[model samples]
Target: MTLTAAQTVAALATIAGSDNVVGDPAKMGAWLYEPRKRFHQSAAAVVTPPTVEAVQAVLRWANENGTGIIAQGGNTGLVGAQVPLSGNEVILSLARLDRIRSIDTAAGVMTAEAGVILENAHKAAEAEGSMFPLWLASQGSARIGGVLSSNAGGVNVLAYGNARELTMGVEAVLADGRLYRGLNALKKDNTGYDLKDLLVGAEGTLGIITAASLKIYPLPEDYETALVNIASPEAALELFQLMRQRAGARLNAFELIPWIGLDIQMRHGMLDRDPTASASPWYALIELSRMAGTAPGALQSSLEAAFDAALISDATIAESLADRTRMWAFREQMSECQSREGASIKHDVSVPIAAVPALIGQGVTAAETLVPGIRPVPFGHMGDGNIHFNFSMPVGADPKAFMAEFDEAVHAVIYDVVLKLGGSVSAEHGIGQLKVDLLRQVKDPVALDMMRAIKTALDPKGILNPGKMLRSVP
Candidate 1:
């Protein structure tokens, strides 16, 4: 705490106008509280810089004063990375810097500011007959800076790749307020150290990303979508290999959903109708992009082949836009629909794509062993092997008590299996304040040291997102 609370607010007001500074704790809730409601911490103040120059000025002041700053975007992050870990830090909101700098459809690139909402970026690309393929449930609210900062992976990673891959370059503010103007549409520049990659996924520990040049693809002519029935993850893995063999890069998304997800969504009316051929133990929401002048029914033909080989039991290919949207709605609502059932312990984890079945089977068995009658609701990007492995509490157990007793235990059980299968404990979500200790425990000793060295070299004063990603330098 280099500055007093009042001093910090007053100094920030001077740097980024009083109107841009929020000193009142009552008004800080919007910036302080996260989506998951797990982190509850107060900030010294909240400041929204309207321009990149203002952001640089604020950073300069914070660095000089030795005050901590947490760079925040839409605040829709599941992990607590954007929120304050200590009460002394100020929340630096980039919401006011939203803008689309430029778009070159021919070049397949769009330059967007940090505060530009992802959905708006999508619209910008689409207006130019292009598409940015990084899709997330929080796209409507998540900002470009935060998305790249987390290196978020969505269902489309099987086709287009994650945020890191979609990004060509980034414009960031280093710890000392130096403008790193690395934004470029270059597909190849093997000159020296790739600094753009360094800051993209550092989670604000290394630098604050202000804007980025994101990759965009030509707008597809149409899409082939379907919902297929599978007996288990093993069968789903086999089907995925077949789809890869058939469709290659055009296979946009292959999502696996268990029977429990359908039951919960239906019991709560999350969908208008079942989006499957018939009742089955599991389902895969498959989609393939149809480019201009290409034929449709690729998904149908592939499914037919799968059926002839007995890889799938039954399937229903979407015939209309309404059906396609409904099927997607079913897949996207997997996380939200769990609330209707009960408290569920969740883990965002990933393993080798080849180990998806082993990861699921062992994880479910371990969870059930820990707590009898626990309902396992594991589902996600099966193609990428990052499953949102979650478990609903026993039917009649007390919600608070269930979470209180099983949250950490369930995490341990699931992570053990994930690690054994060569998986990551934090897959899509960055190692925010929530997973600092876990990261310390599981990350390789040398890799952790390298991360700390990078953090120290960039943020010597530890003023940027202090106590996040890497807790301490030593």
Candidate 2:
């Protein structure tokens, strides 16, 4: 039989002392609330394990009792993965496991606990004269565990790669409470199946990550940042090709933004001043890293070539630190500025780099066709072809009414375009509670069966993050 809520809380408290378990709903606000405010179910209790052994003990108890356990990091995920789905699960918050176990610059790896904040990891790497390049908007609060669990990709992915690429190894507690010590600083280990890759993006359905050895790189001397105006997505794509040809690995970021983003931010006072060169239909925020021995005029020379080719109309290159910060601030605030316009339906989807322009064009057409007055605000990592396809409600429309009427319909239309373009429904964000049904509908049948088989093999009791990435097997 299933345990009662009180019994679950008491069991968790026994595993991780009374001081570490919070059973009161009032005190569970921090763990209950997610970034999107979409998942609001309260957990039976929130457990903060003080040590790796404590995490193992808690998992062992939960597995034996058949209680659900949801592993959470900083609670900053856009999806509902970190929050409770059933309200009876115990939230395993890794907040107490915060630590920087080691940073070996020569070895080019840093070992960080799951609870260590992303920004703190960045600072630690910088202090050691190296860098961890996985930068997201929620770096201040997003923890290493959740970041790896979701396999997050941010602006710098063009140069470095996503969380999965940056992670060298992981240490996790399995569903049955056995510890998998996979941490290593080696450049290669073709020992067997890559278990680290499996747990990194499993969304806590497979295991609870405790710590990881992340790849670090030598810090670049400086960055050449600019915001350039382009005529359309096609023009932006051509200019991106030019950048890649010229800068190669030094090309750090190439983000695309629509005019609607600029209008929304300016109207809402989200930016102190305009970061672009002039008003245009679209913008490409580009940046290139300048190493100590490398020259700084590469970006300027490339922009001149782009200008000659008519790929870009105008541009504003950052001449100072403040200018660079303002440029990035505009790019980073794209998601937040949408709220100023009212209700918005959003998709974090990706296509091949060459198909980004077509995806945006077709997606915008579909969205506008579905909702006559819906405003398209498609933008994001253009180099990687991951666009944050969003649509603002018609002018003066009721946010509740708009969402109720068109949320699902809009998703269908946009996802249709994405799939047709050989793209994925989710790009950077992982499938949590939000995309469970969608994944079932769109994912390949054979692939789904394989996923289920692996999930069953790893977590037979369906205890770790039940009903998350994949639905619980009936």
Which regions of candidate 2 deviate over 4 angstroms?
A: none
Question: What digit string (tens of lDDT, one per residue) describes model 2 on residues 184-293?
Answer: 99897989999999998899999999999999999999999999999999999999999999899999999999998999999999999999999999999999999899
TM-score, cand. 1 vs. native: 0.99
Q: What's model 2's overall lDDT?
A: 0.94
Worst 10 residues of 1 by lDDT: 1-10
- TM-score against truth, every candidate: 0.99, 0.99
Off by over 4 Å in 1: none
Cα lDDT tens digits, model 1, 1-474, are 468889999998998999999999998988888987999899999999998888999999999999899999899888899999878899999999899999999899999999999999999999999999988988999999999999999989999999999999999998899999999999989999999989988888888999999999999999999999999999999999999999999999999999999999999989999888899999999999999999888898999999998999999989999999999999999999988887989999999999999998999899999999999999999999999999999998999999999999999999999999999998899898999999999999999999888888989999999999898866
Local lDDT at 311 for model 1: 93
